[model samples]
Target: MSVTISFNNVIKKYNDKPVISGLSLDIKKGEFFTLLGPSGCGKTTLLRMVAGFNSIEGGEITFDDKVMNRITPQHRNIGMVFQNYAIFPNLSVKNNVAFGLKNRKIPKDEIERRVDHILDVVQISQFKNSMPENLSGGQQQRIALARAIVMEPNVLLMDEPLSNLDAKLRVDMREAIKLIQHEVGITTVYVTHDQEEAMAVSDRIAVMNSGVIQQVGTPREIYQRPANIFVSNFIGRTNIVERSLKKVDNRQVLIMDENYQIDLDDITQYAEEIIKVSIRPEEFTISDTSEGMAGVIQHNVFLGINVHYTVQLSNGENVEVTEESTLGEPLEPGTEVKLLVNKEKINLFHYESEKNILEGDSYAK
Candidate 1:
């Protein structure tokens, strides 16, 4: 059965310097949770703590009602897959997948049955007898996964399992991993520095930085309503523009460079001050006739599905914008245009704290 993992005020230190401190989190049973961040941001440290590879300096780590701070790695009933496919070089695909069960001394018939089932589950059945040397990187990873899951461990830990594969193979394997995880129904804690990969596979993601969790939520929540500026910048690309929020007609009006005015809210309480606006590329509408913010297209690149544009606003600040590819030709670099912001989708942040001022379903409650 899958187990829920909990962390309460967990702390880890290196040479007396705290690496991860005061971290408290909960992972639901059978949830695919990812620890995402840049290197040295404590994501891997946290994962190691969960695996019992690193000692906790403070707080308790628990599996359901049982405290695991003193548990040994081998006794944790956890399976691990690493970036380097840790396949036994001397063994064939079948033996590699059955290694764990064989160690546990399961019945010969039971081992064969489990091996066959998992090889098929991972779609590596055709190469069951093939040696690790003869298989591709992707195939080797399949062996690793099949080996881990065949034991039916309650928790699965994967640390950048796709980092060694080629780009296309990474995408394919991520999809494969997601489907297999749901099918097997095991609680997962994945660690990675790749934001896109984390989002694609995780049921929920914890964004960490400098040993602190910046935010934890579903992909959509973290993207749309980030708790702070660091989170808004980390999860995806955004254009942060300095703007003044003025109360005009008793409504919150976002004033840009004394040239553009857009009403942000009429109900939510916002003190009039200089604020930072976080607008995503897709949250902008660009057109020829003047309707909103005035800007000149600086450059344009047309990808197959969308067109990317860099526009220089009147204040000389440049912002990126993305629009759907159209039948019309791409706009020239010097072309004048009007940029319309999607007020409903934009995010406002307090200048001093850099925390998102609007943090609810519709910007703010």
Candidate 2:
């Protein structure tokens, strides 16, 4: 069965410097939660803390309400998959998966039964007798996964398990891992620097930066409604506008570089004087009959499903616009076009604090 994991005001430090400070999060039972961020963002640090590989300088980590701050790594009952396939090369697939159970002094029959079942679950049953050297990278990864899941720990932790695989194998193995995790129904905390990988496999993501939790939400929420400038730019391609907000006849208008103004009817009236707005590439479309801001297509690239265009506005700022390839012939460089945006989809952040103004607006009392 799966267990709920909680980190309560957790802190970690190296020498006198803090690496993870006052981090707290709850992961639901059987949920595939991911810690996503770039290197030095403390995502791996958080994962290691959960695994009992790092000491907690303050607060506590618990599994199903049981404190684990003082527990040793082996006693915590957590299964871990590493970036390097940690299976033994000389051992056959069956022996590698059985290693954990054997150490526990499980009965021979029980070990065979569990190992056989987990191998099948990971779809490596046919290679049970094959040595690690004989297996492909993806197969070896599957063996490592089988080894971890065979122990049936309370929680499963994976640290960039697919990073060593080739591009196509990463894609294939992520799908495989997701399926196996669902079958086993274990609480999982995955760590990865790849935003796309996190989005593809996680039920929810905790975006971290500089030892702090930035935003925690479902993949769609984090991507579509990022909490700040860091998340907006990190999760995907975004065009951020540093603009001023002013009330113009009962409506808020976004002023771009003291020149162009776009009416922000959906924006709250309590918006700050200056704010940052995030617009995704796919949010812009070619307007019909000059309905919106005019821009010159600086360049265009034809992707399979969409044509990406770099549009230079009159203010000398460039915006990326992605239109469906079905929209018609791709616009050539220097082509004049009118770009329209979804007003409601535009996200606004506080200029100073860089927090999501919309989220604050919802919780404002």
lDDT string, candidate 1, 101-167, tens digits: 9899999999999999999889999999999999999999999999999999989999999999999
On residues 43-66, what C-alpha lDDT tens digit does candidate 2 reach at each position? 998999999999999999999999
Q: Highest TM-score among the candidates is held by which one?
A: 1
Regions of model 2 farther than 4 Å from truth: 255-265, 359-365
Error of 1 at 233 (Å): 0.9
In angstroms, give how far residue 20 of model 1 lies from its true place: 0.6
Off by over 4 Å in 1: 363-365
Judging by lDDT against the true structure, name the best candidate.
1
Worst 10-residue stretch by lDDT in candidate 2? 356-365
